[model samples]
Target chain A: MRYFFKTIHLIDYKNIVPKTVIGLFIILILLIPVFTRNVVTLSTLIMTGIWAVAAMGFTLVLRTGQFSLGQSAFMALGGYASAILTAQMGLPFWPSFLVSGLVSGLIALLVGMVVLRVGGIYFSIITLALGEIVRIIALQWEPLTRGSRGIIASAPPPIILGGHELVNFNASLAPYFYFMICLVAVTGLVFWRIGESRLGRTFAGTALNPVLAEHQGIYLMKYRVIAFTVAGVFTGYAGALYTHFLQVITPMVFGLWQSIQIMIMSIVGGIGSLVGGPIVGSILLYNLGEYLSRLDTPGLQSFLFGSVVVIVVMFLPQGAGLVNLWERFWNKVVWREEEYEPDEPED
Target chain B: MPPAEILIEGLTQSCIYMTMAFGMVLVFSILGILNWTHGQLFMLGAFIVFYSTTAAGIPFPIGILLAGLVMAGIGILIKKFIIDRIKGELYIGVATLALIFALEGAASLLFTSDDRGLAIILPGVLNLGVVAISYQKMAVIIFTLIVMTAMYFVLNHTKVGLAIRAVAQQPVAASLYGISTERLSLIVMGIGCALAAMAGAIMAPLYPINPFIGRTPMIMALLAIVIGGLGSLTGAIVGGLILGFLHSVIAYYISYLSEVVLFGLIILILLVRPQGLFGASAK
Candidate 1:
């Protein structure tokens, strides 16, 4: 709950900004289906929940000055872990979800132990390579992943929790929608707490000045490894949820560009800013991509993304995503007008 | 012919990697920013030749020269207009990545995204013993060596090269000596881009050419430079050769696992020596 409220603080509530503004935005996301009475469209929001989860998980390490370009790899691993184990072996749903996430975490922990020792551009390049390696393995590991053709009909778990048997997947999308909402809520809470915690402070210090942090007696390498390993866990969980949502695991989803895309989303939104990344980054990027494809020029839209990045990085060093509009306005108008002369203070 | 053939083939492959890697290393050593668009520039060079010979009705020799000059002009212009304005190494990197995407977009929009084959030159085999190395293979090796020797002569002997080297080695000291460090950086990039374009043109005949084809080889070239040595020209050449031979041999043998093998080697090298094989310890 505090995590939820903390994100509220992340919002700009300072200058008598109407509470209705924020309230209306939240209501719009929640109450859209009610107004339209179309349950089908809620599906898009469900996937957005998964994107939120993955971004939150990724933000943990990215804040530590370590960019892991292996999100798609971890994601694919988590998705396949659950989909295969449950679909093929007939494992129960609850156990599969937990096991799938743990497997991704375990793999991440192992990779992190080895990979996180390297830093900066080298770290980014290596992670990207590792991602491709994993994707290639997934492509070749036909027995488990079904190769390039991908696995089909991997619907939501058939097993009922506490003996409450579930129906077909389409009929149960409503439940999955709320299920996603819960996942996002839980993820947001955990991520916010971690961001505000001692660990987060350590990460920030380590990122800014590792040598200084080390002199302060902090174990730099250990904390970085921890951050990366922990991030893997959440990304894995997000993947597991995403698998159920898509009900399919494909090699195409784990592409290197896709991994880069996720990275771009986070950075474009804003690093070190909570929830802004997923909202401003993932939702918008994903929506824009879809809108472009619908508008009959996917290539043109992608070109615009590249153009936008060039413009944004050139003009606004601070990302345009999730920026403080009010602060900008106040600085320009109010602060200028309120400047009093020093000579007037003679009394 | 048997073993000599394999050796010459390997040499040709190594020559390609070495040339491209040298270009990358030169830019990085001078600017400290990895030009992510380098691969595109390389690809652009190939397209320049392609467009020149096919569309503009230029002879092979003239087309190659024209393509090199065209690509270099673009590189120099990019450095002056966009990259020179950038503040820091990090921003330069981000900006270069943006350029890669934008160039890819422009290329795709202008040309088909499909692969385009270049006209074959020196297309015959030379039987050495058991190995029969092709004429094109020998030509590639000879051309690369020529480029390398040319670059070496210029860098070691010429006044401009000396100035560029001076600035790269120590910018503050060079500035005290009244050199424009910014102009020197641009010159370094321009030359690097020109060399990269030449590599692209030379290799076009041997491989598939496409707009986005620059990325993989570019990344590999960067890795090669890192593994060889970040700043040393000698390291760049040696590293490129090693990566090229390994990539070709591994791809031929393991097929799909080539990238996996390449990345695995990169990780291993970084873990062992992040400074690279030829790279000097950072100051």
Candidate 2:
């Protein structure tokens, strides 16, 4: 009976409420398509999801103690790869999408292997330079990338199940919205799992203190490269999805600003819970941006975004972003958690 | 195989990059963070110079000086309010980056996004035997030389220079020796920004002045500092010259491919010597 009761309790007291809330929130998100078919609303949600994935990737790289300023380069690589394969080479969309991610991952692995050897501010500068190089290549390589003119990508073909037209991309934004949800779910699941695993702890070790982690038998470069390559793969997928959704692939699509945007999202979202933080951060910021852009006030978006970041950093400090507010609310109010105190001495 | 004109142009480019890089290196050595908004500060300086000289009818030299002083004041305010409160290196860098968008946005809204010029400040060309360079370009070069010499004198000889160097090298030790790191940081930040502004103000005539004009110079300065070695002043100058000459000569030959080649070269150099040419080994 005790065992049964314990089993019913499931896990620690801390996780139960947050987990349940998150699960219910996800279900609510999944039902969003049914409730709203507004193009602006759906597209905003889709873009938010894409940015979230990218932000998650940025946070992952940060977890390994390396600041990657050029993550958007991988996105460009993926977008260009998928665009070339599908639009130019007449390859199927699904296969091209997977291939794009692989190609991006391969490039990332190679770059990480070489650059992670330096592994500090130098690595960051190299990544920044790398983003520029990729953009330049995309711009100059007209034969491959269609130069600055950009390439038009077609929508994914409709899904046919048992001789009935099921999900159609051409019909409405619903399919794209659902697709984005699935991608975010899968990416978030994988990232959350990694965070729960021993690998996450090792990553923390390296990030907290590299020298101590190294002395403890952790190969710093290997772990750093692993985190980077993983991030590259997902960021590539996000890029491919973004390209296909926009129905265009151009050198101007991804650049230094986008890279910085991803960084901002990660930082503002709070790096505490990789999955939750990015999703929340990107959603809020992307919506804010969309609204600000609609106002068409010159520089307002930039100014507001900058001000938000400054305010967050000033108030939160560390990596404690907006998500920290949620955690604080839970601990301070809902849970009524007390400060650490030792039990009275019984002896 | 580039002509003397390109060489002179490269020299002018080198001067701008060198000044920018020197400021960045100085800031990095003292503040322990990369000021990502340094580029926007440069743009602000150019605008100050442009408006002062053209609209306010200030003389060119006075305009440049005004730009420097105004930028220095702005820099001090930023350091005091934003940077000082930030704890970690990463957050501080991001905070400065935030300043970039804010500054750029403010500049765009205030100035409108049109391209402006200051070429009227120095109109005529001075013809040398091998190459005829514009007077504005010549002035840029001469002004840079004077600034560099003056900076060298101040840094090497002045008591304040000793204190600044002391703080940069060992902040805790400097504090023990009755030097205030807080004061030094503010001064360094001021001077660093002033240098960037002056460089921008001087170059306003040579290039189109827009809110976005600061981007390329910022990138070039960053590259120069990295190539020269991050914390080394001399390295910044050498790197600036190398990058400037390489940029002009190569662009003259192959046009846009120079950037790719330049990045490739930087990566190769980093692969071999990670700390840069003059940078100290990683701790």
Candidate 3:
């Protein structure tokens, strides 16, 4: 079995076929609304896409070895900023979205400067506290956020093409679904590019060994802050998208639970594998939670989610989604051939 | 808003925080991982006490004892099975977090999400001139003192305590010197969990017990330990007292916005002293 797997591994499919396959998969996803106009399915897919974006952001920070339990704070900032800009200030959706990402990123940069200095568990605790503080602020700032009652009837995203209003997101799910798909694809592509860049290598180096990276002339603090800010931007974008889609903004929506859910998604998807891991994890876990909840079990969803996490961490440290266990299985059962050797060793 | 009332309330609150911080510090010192389920363990303790006393017809003191013992067993099991297998700070953190979710889910399933309370173990109030203090609050403070003293004694005088301390200080060295580090870990985890359970059981009568009630106290405990210095027992106690006082005094003055003020203070403190008020500089 091992010999067969080695032979299979030797035959590397290093071509554009894999890229084409992914492109085709994305195309199919874009066409889902056309095949079946089920509002529920569309809503779930939209949420999965949004969460996938946030999870990718989380993965970026994880790349720098910083566990931020305050991603929700950035999400809240983006959602609120965009909601306020669009609904109260009468700004266009495009500008509001851009400003939202910028706002979140800037805040993250500032916060990262201070908290990143206190690295490790201290960083995690501080971020957790920061998240809580943001939630509290949202709850207490009644004039701005309307407190726990939240901002109702928030402005929906307007689809505009070449200076003409094409569609209002509130009218139907198709435009919003396509918009989220495009957003997710763009976000994924951006992350993939980053992963293949020198900056991405720096992030990996920092995460793997900060001391070594620092010795090699990489400023750990700078890279850490950059990763955090980038993550904030992505999460903020997702939050803004979420607010516009739901047409409601509440402090409760961006609480610790949401942050934990995003973390769980990232972990389940395989935090090590930046793009596909988190996206797949989010879609599967979100759907699983929703499905379990519908079974009339009060806490079954959380219970099962927790169990999966525990089992994965304990048995499959690389993460269940990230590990290519199926390939090994296929090699063991189906491809039971001897290892190919162009030049056999004398020994 | 009398100073006396605030002081009394603060001290009472400190008792719970101290227990929590103490347990958290113990586990953290030995295992080097923050048990995210610490709060959930506290919640489980409260539920255990509630059920044992209210449903099973056990006496309140017996119920508390039972809760502690049960939680200690759970702690051992978690250590043996889940925590022991997980490696690295990040993975352990995630695993413990998963434990929190699972424990909370299980508690919710067993007890339902409704708020519950135990009958006051010590009823009536003592009218001391201008300040009246309830016997229940007095019991809470007294119980906390007793636990702390006992723990101090065990840690200082007992052979097991010496082994625990030795292992905590230098696990490899202690293991070479015939101390079983693995066994010590299990003991420490059990003791830590038992302490959390005790805190929960004792506080059940004072506050409405729910599956989620542990979260706030847990956060407060986390803050207390952070302020007190992560691995220092003395720091945990002092930090707990400071936080307890701040909580009572701030809540009295600021009402619901006290949480914001507390977290903000933590941020400021971290900025000023990243090592915490009593913690050693990071190694």
Candidate 4:
């Protein structure tokens, strides 16, 4: 009888509340198309979702304690691959998307084999160089990439169900927005699961101290490579989707500026919280840029963005994620006196 | 182009890259943070020279001096306000990146995004057996030599230079020996900024000045630093010359693909010798 009770307690639905909240939030997002028909707003939301996916990828690499400045290179590779496949080879969008992601992951695997040998700042510098190399190649390889003129796809592939075309992505913003939201949601779930897994703990351990991790019998390089490859996969997916959405791709689209923006999103969202941090950061910063641009000051957005990054790093080094703030707020509401008592011991 | 002409062009480019790399190495040694804004400061210096010479009616030499002084002041202020407060490699990187964006934005707004150029102070070309070298290029080479010689003297013989070196070698020990690491860092930042500004001011007459112009030289300086070894000054110089020569020769042969080759070589070097050609293995 006692054993049965213990088992029952273990199976309690304590996690249901947050899950339901997330479900309802997702439902609300799904209902956005019904409520508003603003193309600009839909496009903005779509971009936010796209950036959120990339930022999440960046956060995964950061979890391994490696700063990668070559996200643009992977993104460009994926974009080019998808673009070339659909436009040049006449491949279907779905297959091209998958292949492009795999292509990026394959490149990451190869690059990671060599670059991961040097950790920390050296790794960052090599990645920067790598990004530049990729950009230059894209610029110079005129026959394949069409140089600065860029590639323009005719349309996003239509989803066919039971030999009938179900949805055309190129026709309207609503369907694309829905697709983006779905992608973002799925990516978030995957990242959250990874973060909660034993593998995630191992990545944390490796990041904290490579020597210590090695002492604990962790293959540091293996974990770093895995994390890097996973990041490349997600970033590549985002890039592929972005190509189809825009229907035109350029080497200049995924340059250092885009890379920096992704990094800023990850950092600003608070690097600690994998799911909420990046999504919130992407929305906030992207919208902030839009808002600043509307104010008619040409460089004010960039200036403010830079200032925000410096301030956030200095004051909230963990990031500006809402999870911690929410937890603190909940604690204050439920047990303020108990929380305050712990401070007395330090004093 | 003749081989002799390519060599001269390479040497001239190397001198500019060397000065920039020297400043980068100095700051990297002391602060242990790569200043992403270093290139922007170089741009700022050129603009200052442009304004002083064109708008304020100052002479070329005096304009260069003014740029150096102004940049030093800016560097000192940046150290005290932004860098001093930031700790750890990651935070410093982010902060410096932020500084780059802010400076770039300011430059775009203040100077307009258009490209500006300075009149060549020296216009005549010197004729040689197989090559005709411009006097402007000669001036750049001579100026670089003079600046480097003066830097060597200061670094080797001066008290402040000793203090700077001691702090870089062992911050705790130097502090124990009555050197203030804080003050030393501020001074080093100023000196580094001044050198970058001087390089910009000198190179301004040769190339068009723009808000985004610092990026290429900055990348070259970084590549030079990496090739020569991260913290070693001599390595930076050697790396700069090698890169400069490669750039000139490769661009001559392959036109636009020089950048691809240059970066590829850096990656190759890094894979084979992660410690750099002349640098000690990093701890």
Candidate 5:
């Protein structure tokens, strides 16, 4: 019975990826219209999309052996900058977006200069400090940010789909959800390409063995800076999406807790796992929390999250552990020697 | 504010900051990790004091002491069971993060996220010239000093402290001399956590107590330890003073920009001395 299943999987592996993706995405996209009539469902989908995009950006840096606990900080940087630009300055929506990305990129560029020097827990600590610094500035600069009172009614992006223009994407959650879906697809494609690029190889090598990579002329500093900047761009995209989703901006939006939560999402999705953002860690757990709160207080929610992390660290250590474990079992069932490792460049 | 009052507040605040920083330095000296949950341990201490005094009907002094002992136990368990198995900073980070969530969850479930003030150890005020100091706060300051001084003596003079220090300086070498470096780690965690707990118990009446209250002092302690160097016990105290004074002085004048100003100083300090002001190392 195992042999039959193995033979089928071995023959159908190439065809499986697209089918599975399409199957899940269709279920989700179909629910969009069905659930569009309900505001809460739409909001949830939109948020999940935005968070996934940001996590992908985070995943990019991890590929080159970098970690960012400051994702929410950049998100806030983009969110606030663009909100201020378009709403307060009356700038064009697209220009404000590009500006947001640029601001985040520039900030990342500057901070990354020193931050890149550190790695592991030190990296998380620096980013945590940086995030708090950003939060404090946002809170205290009441003239610009309006302090903890929070700014409301920051307008959303203008969407152009198939030449059909919608002025306010935030008017309804459906359009924003669709917009974020495109972002996820685009961000995933970009990250996959970068992960396969020579630059990514240098980063991967640096992460794998920094001393060796430096000896081989990988130029660790250059790649580190690039990875940080790229992360900034994608993170900014997520931020812009988040601002629209929440329909308000505040220093409270990007606290150290939020940053840690996002980091948890990326890590739970498994390090370097693209699109693991929504599926594995924070998003799934966060969604579960939201749903569970309808029944009881949110106290038990974090407990569940902690338990998940403990389990992952103890038993899995690799990822969700299901897929990786299944793949291993399938390999043994098929007796495929080539499945031992993928030495070729990532596709 | 009068000169004397300002001096009193500054000194007291600096003492609080130094106690927290001292605990942080101990962890780094022994475990070689920043122990992000150090702040949460401090938070638990506060909560435990509040619980023992208010809910369990214990006297203030007894409540505070019990809180310290209980939290120290939790700290040892964390070091032995959770942190012991993890390898690499990243994995340790993930594990501690799990602990953070768990602790926060427990805090939320048991005591609510809302901040609750604790009863003072000794209430009323003591007026001396321009300065009018709260007796409760003065007691906190005194307690803080005693603990800090006691810790300093133990670390510098005692046998167990010497063994712990020896392990921190060189784990491999210490183990060869039959130090049971692992056991020493548990003891260090206990001492570190006990100090943090005492700090929380003493300050419970001053600040509005909450599950996440640990966040601020931990950050301040981080600055103290980092500025002092990651593993420098003495640096932690010095850094704590620098940061504490930075807070009192800036918050006195700048108010809103105080946090930013403080971080700016830390960044400048770090740029100049990455190993910290004291230049301590884990190895």
Candidate 6:
């Protein structure tokens, strides 16, 4: 079986089973809407997807060796932009949605240009402050954001195929689920490409040793800005989708806590694989949070969340997250790979 | 010109920020990772003081001291078990961040989330022509001054302080010189947390206490440290004072718009001086 697995080359796999399994897993997820359209299940999955995108963005920024503590601020910016454009100004949902991501990306670009110049704990502190600033703005800017009362966002209009409604968002969540799947897929694909490309290598260089990378003629700020901006764009999209799904945009929705949540999701998921880590981490943590939230306990969710993170960090130690465990299992149990060490000669 | 009342409020704000910022910067210099639970620790400190003073009938001063000692013990445990074991700065940060939720959650569960006011520790007012400051506020200021002085003396004049400064400057060399970085870290963590607890305990009487009250002050302290320059004790003080006064003056004129303006100022400051006002250039 090992020999057979080694013989097949789907993408550069010494072991092909994991790849095939991952492909099958994606197919199965795509087929979830067909199997069951249960509201509870679909909404949970939708939220997981939204959070996954946000987590992926966070992981991408982390790739460049910069900790972004205000990721939710971008989410808020995106949500508010889309919410105001659609609900207040009466713009079409689809166009406003696109604009939301762009608006978020633009802000990230501007902020990144200024802050990425420093690129350290300073960046982290500034971003944290940015989250609070965005929240305060959303709260005080009553005419636009409707203050703390929140702005209600309408769901996407139904898709018409040959004069018949194909997917009506308001009628069922299946459409929304499919939409979420597409968003995650697109984001995953782009992130995966980035990770596989030279840009990703440059990001690794910057992260591992800034001085060495700079000496190698890599403009650290440029790559940092790029990673931050790209993450911002997708985070914005995720935020916009989340607002439309929830049908409301409130200042209370995204702030320091949400940003921390995104950071936790990304870290717990493992930063090993850009796309896979975030999806796995967000799905696991988000589902866990949802379950805990339903228990009617005040602090159980937080306590459990903290405990889990603490445990993961203690065990994982490095950048190895939950995905690392899966890899270890495959290598040790399934592959039965033996350790390679040269024998030492004793006198 | 800002009124004297605003200046007094700023002073009160600055004292809290200075204590919190000072402790945080000290910890960061030694631990090399910001204790994300610093705020939660502050909250716990307030809870501890409130219970001891009100329920246990402990004297107010003694209650504050108890809060500090307990928090120091907690901080030491966190450093030894959780922080010390975690390798890498990023992971340590995430670990501490998780602790925030855990600590906050535990606090909420144990104390409940309802607002509980600390019985007035000092019940009087210092009436000046321009403004009359409450005794509680005055206590906060005086307590902060005493703490700051004690810290300055310790950091500058003591053997342990010398070890701490050496470790912060050169960890490897300091370790080689027989100064146990591990032991020093534990002490620093204890001191940092105690300072945070003291700040919380001191401020307890002035505001309604809850498990979540640590959030705002934490952010303010964080901003203070950033502005003053991370890892610089004097910078933390200066930064705290500037932020407090700036916050009050801005809020007074523009109300809630102060938050935006404060953040804007941070960005501006960073653009001009990335290392902060007192921070040395990054290596």
- lDDT by candidate, in order shown: 0.72, 0.85, 0.82, 0.81, 0.73, 0.88
lDDT of candidate 6 over A1-347, digit per residue (tens) = 01111111112223525677778987999899899979999999999999999999998998888888999999999999999999999999999999999999999999899889987888998999889989999999899999999999999988799999988999989889989998999999999899778898788668777877889999999999999999999999999999999999899999999999999899788875688789889999999888888867788778887898788789883646786666666667887876322222111
Q: Sort every candidate by DockQ, greatest first.
A: 6, 2, 3, 1, 4, 5
Docking class of 4: acceptable
lDDT of 1 by residue, B1-283 (tens): 2245556666776786787788878888787777778888888888888888778878766776776788878988888877776554444555677677778877877776789987787778888677787777777778887888888899989987888789778979988998887888777887788878878888878888887888877877877876787788899898888887777676766777777887898789878987778777732
Q: Looking at model 5 chain B, which ten-residue stretch has the lowest summed lDDT?
A: B274-283
Clashing residue pairs in candidate 2 (N, C-alpha, C atoms within 3 angstroms): none
Candidate 4 residues B1-283, lDDT tens each? 5388998999999998999999989998998777778898999999999999988999998988899899999999988988877655666677788777788878887878898889998899999878889999998899889888998999899999899889889999999999988888888899889989989999989999998888888888988998888898898888999989889988889888888888888878877888888988853
- DockQ-best of 1 and 6: 6
Task: Please give, for residues A101-172, the per-residue lDDT of candidate 5 as tens digits.
Answer: 889989999998877765543455577788889999998888788889766635565667788885456456
Best by lDDT: 6
Ordered list by lDDT, greatest first = 6, 2, 3, 4, 5, 1
- Runs in model 6 deviating more than 4 A are A1-19, A339-347
DockQ of each: 0.41, 0.46, 0.45, 0.39, 0.34, 0.57
lDDT of 2 by residue, B1-283 (tens): 7799999999999999999999999898898878887888889999999998778999989999999999999999999999988766777877887788888888888997799887667778888777899888889999999989988988889988888888889989999999888999999999999999999999988788888888888888998888878799998999899989988988899886789998899888878878788888854
- Backbone clashes in candidate 5 total 1
Model 3 DockQ reads: 0.45
Candidate 2, superposed: residue stretches over 4 Å from native:
A1-18, A339-347
The TM-score values for the models, in the order shown, are 0.88, 0.95, 0.92, 0.93, 0.88, 0.95
- Chain A TM-scores, one per candidate? 0.82, 0.92, 0.87, 0.88, 0.82, 0.92
Better of 2 and 4 by DockQ: 2
**lDDT tens digits, residue span B1-283, model 6:** 9888899999999999999999999999998878888898889999999989878899989988999999999999999999888776777888999888998888888988899997787888889877899888889999999999899899899999999999999999999999999899999999999999989999999889998999999999998988888888889999999999999999999997888998899889878888888998764
lDDT per residue (tens digit) for residues A139-238 in model 3? 8998888889887635455767999989877677998898798788888888888876888877877766677678999999999999999889888898
The DockQ assigned to candidate 5 is: 0.34
